[model samples]
Target: MHDFLVDLLICPKCYGELDWQIEQRSLNHIEKGEARCQVCHTSYPVQDGIGYFLLPDSGREDLWQEVDSHLVQHLQQNPEIEKRLMGVPLETLSPADQFFRAMVHEEREEFELAEESQSVANSGIYTDAYLSCWQSQTKYLMDRLASNDKPLIDLASGRGYLVEKLAQNHDFPIVATDFSPKVMRRNRRWFEYLGISDRVSLLAFDATKMPFKDASLEIMTSNLGLPNIKGPSELLHELRRVLAGRFMSITHFYPVDDNQNRELLRQANLETMLVRDLASAAFEQSGLQVEFTNICLSLAEPTPVGVVLEGAGIDALPVAETNLEWCLLEAQQSSKAKH
Candidate 1:
């Protein structure tokens, strides 16, 4: 991580200022160090150029872990399956199979191949409208990102798709944050391979309790990350506390009348983060004025989870097929914002 980042950070656990002691540095990047909070005495480590700032008691569920674990075990037991699958042309594979193929590419550090596999899988699965809007949304973020020279932190930067695009397309510093250390490590290698490591840094931190100093950040962005955060009741408040500028997020909402998916979203207790009106209200309750803009509706069908072995497909959540309204969330401090 950059030395400049130390000034922007505080202890996420206690919000106390930290004392950074660097043990190793490569010019501007600190590859090894410990950032200890002066008040609470919580020591966070900087490893492999990514700062580990997650809370000790973080109870977040990692869907990636499940997939990786099952895939690893499946490949070990059925050794020939990997060769058989890899030998097939990517075009002939099902979207579900393509998804697993991408996983394999990722393991081998074949970044471009993994992305190619993902593109094929996504094209086969999601509706045309879904792909169009996703492309447009990414383009929109890339355009907006060019205006700011200051650093940007992409929250919940799983798999690093949005962040990669931003880094490649824009001329701004980016700090990609996720709760998963494994994801961060993967991103470090991937970004290095892409030759964009200098412009990007990695941090493993929970979004609800960010490591940023209070009101110190000018901009924060996320691509479809908001609704996935656990315990968002306090999250909005926490975001407002730390942001002096704005938080721009790309999110999609399922129709409340879409009985199958709507009930599923509500049961997950993510109504405030998904439903447009509910999201706005929740932001206002947290003392941030919010607006939903650039809205577009798209239809999405369920994507089949492919098997690594017989009957052991990656069982991921939210397989609901339905229509969705994609939009950008603009949230900033309100004049009426209460401390």
Candidate 2:
């Protein structure tokens, strides 16, 4: 982590000032170190330039990450499966199988080829309306970020496309945060490979237990990540507490009236983020002025199951067809709260 960012951070446990002891340094950054809270004495480590500020009794998990843990283990044990999938012509495979192949390539650290395969897979899954909405939001976000050079924190980044695009196009310092150490570590390597390693800082910490001082962060962002947090009432309040600027997010909400997917969202307890009114009210109650724009809707059908992998469930999406309403959620810290 950069030595300069230490002032922006606090002990997640006690919200106390930290005494940083640097063990290794390279140029302008601290490669390895320990941060000890002055009040509570909890120690958080910094490794490979990514600070670890996670709480042991954390209430959040990025379980909504696209890469499935089980399938990774499956591919690790079955080496021949990867070979078999790669040998097949991409032209003939089902889109779901192509997407699965792309993920396998990602697991193997062949990111360039994985990206190519992912594009091919997405063409089949996302309708033109969906693609247009995504492009619009991404452009909107980049345009918005162009005006500000402040340090920005992205919550539950999950190695998603949103942050990578930001790091490539924008000059500002960006912090990509998630609760998982393994994910952050892999992302550090990925950024290095992409030649934008200097553009981003990785911090592993729970959203509910922020390492930042209250209203200290100037800007924040997410790409369909907020909805995935386990319980967001506390998360939203914590988000409001830390962000003094706007939180710009690119997300899509499922049709609430679609009974086909009704039970599914309820079972997962995702009404707050998936239901428009509930999501807006949740953000408002947390002391933010919430608004959504760039609104559009598109027909979404069930993604084809993995035919090449013998239908072993490549990934999960809605099983029924529905209209997905895509929007850019922009929430600002309430002016009243500033006083």
Candidate 3:
């Protein structure tokens, strides 16, 4: 929404430069406006201080709006939760607490089910062992990330958990990009409420073809989002096009080569090598090198999905290489190399 963001934006349809048609403004941010492409003549809108660079055919807007309304009502019902989130910003609550509170407010029904399922799964040793591994890996990643001040774009930032954490802990500006208008609207409201809006901006766009120009961005991140993308290679290729530094992501990785893991993947209609191979190929195509890969989430017990499937007599559940830690990558043409 900032005036300077115009420099980084391009026509999603044709990747051409755009001319702004401002209808409203708030200080330095554009409250409402339209961006017309210089080449293709395509027009994208800026609403609620967030820019929408999505294509004409993008779905999920209405569903997400409904989700946002439910989330807001959920927050309103819980006085303690609302107070913690709206009060004192960073000093009032821990990042984990804030994250949990937000999750409860945003996905109360799902969170309750997950907790119940986790209780059932925690009776097994798998869950404990997984948590231990996940903790160690995440600690290392947070340590490294704490020292990084590079401008970052967190793609597929559902509900802005990482964005909230980063905005609270770091001094640099962060861009939270997603495909859902309602999600972005909620993100904007949450950031503003937390007093971190000054450090964050919400953007609505497709991951396969981001609005950012070639080599304009330093870092890109997608957590638990790679699996949802149908064509990750194309998304990676797009990441390579815009990222001048690196693309870091954390996603579920199944051990397809293992018999048990292979069976689990089969039940889910997934291939173990799908994300790994796609990311590797995409990194190579984008002229990026794989920097680090960590085990971010070690599943000590069955996941909610796994528990349900197992309860239904499906013995094979996804277990191996469950959640990867912050896998850091570096672009070959990076302008700013991290120390």
Candidate 4:
């Protein structure tokens, strides 16, 4: 467990700080310790290294018993299959390992996509057009925030497409960051291509743990990134923690389907304003006060049925022209909150 996670724990009876004691030699069993509240004289027992802060007679035992049964069943499953399927070393796996594995898988897929795009760029076929498309998209977003004069932070800023575009029009410093080093190198190339290598700084940073002081940045934005994140709430909290002026995130807004996604939004508790109700709910969510929201419709020819079927490997029918709706959201972070 992280040292910061200790902030989440408190005495259940007296709501005071309970001393963390390591009873066993193993780190996994360190939670097994008797906790006595200094204020209320209430003692909580530790069973199997899990501290039960609730009273012994409390009705919460049924919930904990169900959780314990589920864990036992999970442990009974095949270790090798669990390792291959979940990318976890089942024997040493803890709750933190499970969360980290999920994030690793998500990042692996994103890196694969970035590699494919780089391959296409190196093919020398439509390279100019591909780069132009990225440049245009970046410009479109930057133009909307023309009035803001603060430094910009691009979260999950793969290849620095947005950063380079902003550099072309504005002189403000740009911090381009991504979890993958491959993407950060791509971003460096973008700066070199734009002749603004000195203006943009690239860093490998996890969005959940932003490396910035509180209220250090004026603007924060992410394009086609947040949806791929597993810990959206943590990312949002970090964004709010570092942003000094405004926070903006552009993402593919899919409807909540599972408990994980539901819990993510619940933890963030962000005040969201949707631009336009698209078929797929493509909208931007901002923690700041939304000043404007607009929708832009673009038309493109659909992919061929054979290519679609081969790529997705699911279903194929017919190809037709379709309209795609993109949302543009602008908001300002309130100065009142230091979060």
lDDT of each: 0.82, 0.82, 0.63, 0.47
Summarize candidate 4's per-residue lDDT along 1-339 as a digit string, tens digits. 112223334454445556555465243223245556567666655434233444434332331232222322443465653444354243333323333333333333444433333343232322343334434556667776787776577777775556666778887666676765445544555465558765565554466665455566767787756654555556656665566676665532323332443344345542122112321122224354443334444442322211111222111111233333345445455444425
For TM-score, candidate 2 versus 3, the one ahead is: 2
Clashes of 1: 0
Residue 305's C-alpha lDDT in candidate 4? 18
Clash pairs, candidate 3, are 126-300, 126-301, 127-300, 127-301, 128-300, 130-298, 130-300, 296-325
Q: How high is the lDDT of residue 46 in model 2?
A: 89
Candidate with best TM-score: 1
lDDT of the structure predicted as candidate 4: 0.47
Which parts of model 3 are misplaced by more than 4 Å? Answer: 62-104, 107-139, 146-149, 260-278, 294-297, 305-339
For TM-score, candidate 1 versus 3, the one ahead is 1
Candidate order by lDDT, decreasing, is 2, 1, 3, 4
Model 4: how far residue 335 lies from native, Å: 7.6
Positional deviation of residue 98's Cα in model 1 after best superposition, in angstroms: 0.5
Model 2 residue 175 lDDT score? 88
